[model samples]
Target: MNREMLIKLWQAHKNDEWPHVETGQEGPLMTLDTVISGCVVYVLDGEEDLDEQRRAIVSDCLAELDTLEIEINDECRSYFGRLREIGTLLLITT
Candidate 1:
């Protein structure tokens, strides 16, 4: 919900990016695809039994990702579609 929580998650992902770096890369080498996908899954599954705070946090993450200029590839597009379907179902049921 807060900036601190979002920063924590981002930092975790940032740390996780190190091992995936290519041999000759200079900066962080992780794909936006992988990072965003992990974030999406974390928001969805991690917030499955959400409290108000968790829902707000997940919503904030989703909003932040929504604002970014991410180039979704075919695989990421498919995951997004699936996430939309799941989100729709949750909305309808709740």
Candidate 2:
């Protein structure tokens, strides 16, 4: 991610602020819990398989989570781990 994206990501994820939603199934959509996971979802964007560029972006976003220093609860930890698994394939195949 570039500096601008990093800035936006930090802004969105800062203070553990949740996304504002008037109506949605928050219970089932754990991806929205953090900006990084949300970026994973956006990169996937309903794709059935991961492409190289998409994979890198997702991987970078997941790795970027570490620098954020936010507490990862059980739910987000599981979600992020799953995303990492999906992107890790890029390391071998790319």
Candidate 3:
């Protein structure tokens, strides 16, 4: 994930502008999940390939995601599961 995108996501999260589930579109949530998943892949593939600064941004983004208050409805279960898995992998590998 690029720094600009992370910053945008962070800003959107801070503004409570994401998680568009109420609109019947889980796009923003999906985007966040994808970005985090990508981070995990990159971290596993080669942590050295990612810029140190970008790694910090990713870490901060994941931390921010950790603070999110998502409802555990059926629609969100898979996403949350993957998020938790990603978080665990990050904790173990990073």
* Residue pairs with clashing backbones, model 3: none
RMSD from true fold, candidate 1: 10.8
As a TM-score, model 3 comes out at 0.48
Model 3 accuracy (lDDT, Cα): 0.52
Candidate 2 lDDT over 1-94, as tens digits, reads 2333433443444435443332433432344234335443554454334466656665665565453325555545544444344334333333
- In model 1, state the lDDT of residue 60: 50
Tens digit of per-residue lDDT, candidate 3, span 1-94: 4433434443343344333354433554565566766765565456434556656655665665565535436655545544655544454445
- Report the backbone clash tally of model 1: 0
TM-score, prediction 1: 0.35
Query: Scored by CA lDDT, what does every candidate get?
Result: 0.40, 0.44, 0.52
Q: For candidate 3, give the lDDT of residue 57.
A: 57
Best by lDDT: 3
Clashes of each: 0, 0, 0
Better of 2 and 3 by TM-score: 3
Candidate 2 weakest lDDT stretch, 10 residues: 20-29
Residue 92 displacement in candidate 2 (angstroms): 2.3
Better of 2 and 3 by lDDT: 3
Misplaced by over 4 Å in model 2 are 1-56, 68-70
Cα distance off (Å), candidate 1, residue 77: 0.3
